[model samples]
Target: MAPNFSDLVEEARLSLQALVDYGDQLFNPTVRLGVTGLSRAGKTVFITALIHGLLRGGRFPVFEAFATGRIARARLAPQPDDAVPRFAYESHVRTLVEERQWPHSTVDISELRLVIDYQRPNGADRTLTLDIVDYPGEWLLDLPLLAKSYQEWSAESLKLSRQGPRLPLAAAWHAHLATLDPRGRADEQETLTAAGLFTDYLRACRDERFAMSLLPPGRFLMPGGLAGSPALTFAPLDVPADGSAPDGSLWAMMARRYEAYKDVVVRPFFRDHFARLDRQIVLVDALAAFNAGPEALHDLQAALAGILDCFRVGRRTFFASLLRPRIDRILFAATKADHLHHASHDRLEAILKRMVDRAVTQAAFAGAEVDVVALAAVRATREVRMRRGHEQLPSIVGTPLAGEVANGEAFDGSTEVATFPGDLPTQPDGLFSVPADSGSFKGLSHFKGLSHGSADQADYRFLRFRPPQLDNDGGDTPYLPHIRLDRALQFLIGDRLT
Candidate 1:
């Protein structure tokens, strides 16, 4: 068997891109670092904090290059690709540093370039360019489609929809699917209605209440202006387990559109941005999965496994680029450490490791240097000791997001409060799920009837806090506070700077 012409063209493009990258890096040491995570995983905040840390020389003790004073300076540079939107660093940082508020999450792909001047151990001065590509982790969830046919995807999706937590949310979509005849001719309005219902189902699954993580066809949730287009209008059709779609039929129409989605949306993303990475970091809101209970935790684990499978996991070397790009290092960072007390940070990391164990193992088996960290790009809360009847407890103090309730009291977004964000188990085994006897749906009983303050009562649940206030020091000396972002930096790009 031989690769078809289309496959040949794709390979040529990949090789050419790699060659261009290699040639460019010979003169300018550049690392294409990719940052992405599922929605609300803090991709935007992570990028903002990372750039602010580098440019402002933020206080990061663990990042070797910065800590050892080997780095002269880091400055923003024009990104190499003009076609891609520049990450709005200035605006986002302002809201975070000045206004003391979080910025909006990422909706599409954006890039930033930071040029760092450093002194090598031998005292020779060198410069390295870091190109950071930030995109929605939702899109990364679609990579599995690269190897799946529409039928396979449909079957998998339908089967998943019928599962414990998803079954209820997928009710309408399943009903709509049932009404449509796969063998009949495709109708425009009917197709639109089905797609709309399917997208709605995905939205429900991704709601903060649910915190589910495995929704695919990423564009369905955040269309990015692709709404109503044919490529985004297809829904999975009901089909027999082993049957082919007939030409000019409803199933065929959906099949064409599904393939079109892969060709038009998924393939180009991999070819243009994904495959070019030298290092990658996947930020995870592991606590959310914990709060969502066992079913969501297992779903997240499955999602992570699928997403990690798409990586060309291996060490990046000169030879790797000559053939194709390889991501040498991959870091899975559990974001939002500030929400909990420092005492449990390691436990959080351990719990996240268990959450992503299979994915990390797969990447490690391929010789990729994989690491995990509990990080907060911005530490929104300060730790304090609160006494409850003579017993001192470690707690975090910050201004909660407006309307955040505690003990039936609502925060005004300006009043500071100290609350004990509960702790994780020293052993990671008992964290993601409750006992089966407690309730059904894979231990969702752990979060039974959780809402507002009651939900926050869950040991793993944490409240959202506003960004911390910064001192009078202006832009030139911006030093944002963070938790272990330096360690993350040390793992991802410390060697490149050296």
Candidate 2:
């Protein structure tokens, strides 16, 4: 079959953009860096802290360019896309640094461009644009939808919903599905009601307690400005395996809207935002998965795998990627290392590596460089030693966020206290094991149990701490405290400077 004209036109447009980018690079060098993570993964903090650190010329022994004084200065410039919202860096940083409160989560895709001026060995000054793009991880989960038809998505979603932890939450949505007849004529009210129920089910599964990572139609959770639009109003149906939707039928209506979502919501994002990246960072809230138990852990792994598939991880020419951009380097980071003691930081990185092992393998095999790091973009706590009876316990001292509880005691957000966070397993696979009785989700049986203390127990005492106060010089910006951020910078853009 011959290719469609619209497909050809899109290919040509993308290729032209790539050629333009290539031509611009002749005089102006730039790197598009993508920042994303699941809800509460601290994407905002990472970006804010990274910028603050560079602008302040912070002490970073690992980031060679900055540490060695080769990089003269880093400053923000006008972002490339005027249509896209600029990342609220100043506001977010002030809240995190001065007010000691966490910033708001990202609901829509935003952009920020940083121009770094560095001194060269040849006595010349050089500069490059670091374009940071931020978006919700929920949206990334929808990448898989491109490869699936409406019927396929419905069947798979139903299967996933029927499993552990999700079954109870999906009760209402399931009830609504049971009442609907796919072959019946499409009714506007019925369509809206089903979408509402299904959306509710997705939200319920993502409650803080569960922290599920596999939810799709990502707009359902962080709809941005698309809330209530027909593009966001479709839900899966129980269409028979071989069923065909007659025009004006409920199934037909849903299928049509699903296609529109892919065209309007998914494709544009993939082309304009995601696919163009030169390097990327995927932040993971690993601690949340531990708290949510084994099922959530498995879901996170699957989500990462699905997301990995979306990245074109390989060595490709600019022309090749103008058609389909290939990410040259990708970093998967375990965020919120401050939630645990310093000793567990390595363990956290190891566990994150295990979680994305398969995806990492795929990326590396395709010739892309990949790394995993455990970091707190903004260090929110300090290590303390507490003498308890005969044992000196390692603890973290920080102000707990208001209403945050420890041992049934609530914090006022201003009182500082030391609390002993529980230990993580010495080995990584402990979190991947699935017990014999958990014959629930597919491919999950291959998981090994996450032994909280031993090889047999499962637990993680994940806690929330308020952002720490900085002894600032009263400048417009100050260096934000962080863990392993220098190493992350080295991996992300070190080569570009060299």
lDDT of 1 by residue, 318-368 (tens): 887888888889999999999888988998898788877878888899889
Give the lowest summed-lDDT range of ten residues in model 1. 443-452
lDDT of 2 at 54: 89
Clash totals for all models, in order?
0, 9
Using TM-score as the measure, which candidate wins? 1
Which pairs of residues clash in candidate 2, taking residues 3 or more apart in a chain or in different chains? 430-449, 430-450, 432-447, 432-448, 433-447, 433-448, 433-449, 434-447, 451-457
Clashing residue pairs, backbone N/CA/C < 3 A, model 1: none
Off by over 4 Å in 1: 1-4, 432-460, 474-478
Error of 1 at 81 (Å): 0.7
Point out where model 2 deviates above 4 Å: 1-9, 316-323, 435-460
lDDT of 2 by residue, 291-395 (tens): 676788888888888888888888757557556667889999999998788988998898889988988998999999999999999898898877766877677
